[model samples]
Target: MTDPIYAIPDIHGQDALLDEALERVARDGGPQATIVFLGDLVDRGPDSRAVIERLMQGQAEGRPWRVLRGNHDQMLLDFLDRSVIHSPRVASGLSWLNPRLGGAETLASYGVTAPDPEAAHAEARAAVPQAHRDWLARLPLWHEAGPLLFVHAGLRPGVALDRQDPDDLMWIRAGFLDHAEPHPWLVVHGHTALDHPAHFGTRIDLDGGAGFGRPLWPAVFEGRGCWLLTDSGREPLTPAE
Candidate 1:
């Protein structure tokens, strides 16, 4: 039999909640289980640095973990790169560093406190560890497990997986969300915020608005089914039914 897979949704800098979720996974799936973090590890809440640090430690310890890159995660990378800010893909004058997008909070998590965006960007760049930045930059946009395709966001319907745009993989919404047809694989994602995990048979959305004051929804997938890991134990996820 295959080892159980734990699917953790967007953390959004809530390290305490992440701790609880991982503990629950360990209790239920044991220490040898595979854990896949569905991205959005930084921004919004407090302690994004703590979240990243913990994951880095886990990686260093050689734990069974896979980290995907979320749009917010890419935004941080873009901010650090600087050149991307002027690209046409981004809004003409919008700054990813704006608090509305949670970049400021991420910077704050790294001990950067500045009166302006420019100062904050410089401090954040200087404060963030090279290792952490390197890890974040190297994160894969998606991970495949048998029939399941795990990504930070939904995939564009009808497009070949290899040909799918990287931006769409991390940031697409309406086009991917509204599609009713099934893809070649079960797309497990965490980008669009929902009150609970929205399991649509063909696709499963694990983003439970944890970045906006909701509980993080960590799940387990085995064979052809999935279950939500709670304090009480595993509850079969049937959001579509």
Candidate 2:
């Protein structure tokens, strides 16, 4: 059997689901199996702070886990460090704290509340621990292991890996998602959530919209094939032709 590398994607602040997914991973792959987190670890749910702390604690315990930065994660950092409410990467002036984006829920996870936007910023700054900010800032945009290349969002097709824009890695959708050609590596990502994991010939998207109250399923890759890791066992994922 090929050695398995597990991946969890777009956690989006659902600590309960995160816990269940981690347990499933451990049950299937043992304690030392390499796990890649494809970003979006915050917002859209009720417990972003707990989610961050759990990942941090796992890494500190010396687990072979790689965490990538997602657009939501970046938005949180921007709000805390620069007071940037709206992201230029997104259109329609969609601020991070917009109800749809779920930034308010993240702030609540940190026990932060304020009377106004200005006060919110200051309160968030004081409430969020410096270590979390440091960890979020240090997360890489992508990770490569053998034939697998992991990212938060899909990459821009035709751009070389080194030349890919950071924003595109975390926020892009159009070209990357619609592209029919295979990427440099079998790109594993989670940004565009589907009712289930999507297996295009070139990429596998593991985001099952845990933030939207759907299930958060972890997937494992071995060579070019994939499977959804569940409590019972592995469920094979066939690529779309």
Candidate 3:
């Protein structure tokens, strides 16, 4: 029998929720299970640092955890490395540190203050350790396992998986979300922030809007089927019959 694969989506700095989700995974899948985090590990919650650090420690301790890069994670990197006010793929004037995306909350997790937003760049650089930055930068854009492809966001329709743009992988919403056709693999992804994990016939969106006070639901995949790894137990997930 194939080992079950576990996936968590869009933590968004809710470390407590993350802990609960992981505990459930461990209970169901045990300590040796492989977990794929669907990105947006930072921003919008109270403890981005705690979330990142926990994941980092787990990976360092030889846990089979795969982390993907989210658009918001890219925003923090852009600010620290390029001093950009916002992500180039995003709107012209939208700063990452803006209250909406919760970059300020992320910075606060590192003990850096974003009083003026612009002026907090140097402080953020100093306060956030280089190891953490390196880990974030090194996060892969996607992870493919068997017939499932785990990515931060849905892929662009009609584009070959290898040919898909990195920006589209992390930030896309338009064509990818609306497209009804099935791709080569089951695109398991987050970033859309739905109220619940939605399993379209062609794909599964596991992002339960943990960034917006929703639960950080983890999912288990076995062969072609999926289930919600809730506190009570595994609940089979599928498109409406």
Q: What's the distance in Å from true for residue 122, model 3?
A: 0.7
Summing lDDT over every window of 10 consecutive residues in candidate 3, give the lowest-scoring window: 85-94
List of clashing residue pairs for candidate 3: none
Tens-digit lDDT string for candidate 2 (1-241): 5688999999999999998998899898898989999999999899999999999999999999999999999999999999888888777787788878989999999988774668899999999999999999999999998888999998889888899999999998998898988777999999999999988878888998898999998998888788998878999988865
Encode model 3's per-residue lDDT on 1-241: one tens digit a residue: 6899999999999999999999999999998789999999999999999999999999999999999999989888987887776766666566777777889899999888858755788898899999999999999999999889999998888888789899999999889888888888888999998999989988899998999998999999997799999879999989977
Model 3's alpha-carbon lDDT is 0.91
Candidate 2, number of clashes: 0
Of candidate 2, the 10-residue stretch with the lowest lDDT total is 111-120
Is candidate 1 or 2 superior in TM-score? 2
RMSD of 1: 2.0
Q: How much is the lDDT of residue 188 in candidate 3? A: 95
Clashes of each: 0, 0, 0
- Displacement of residue 158 (Cα, Å) in model 2 is 1.9
Clashing pairs in 1: none
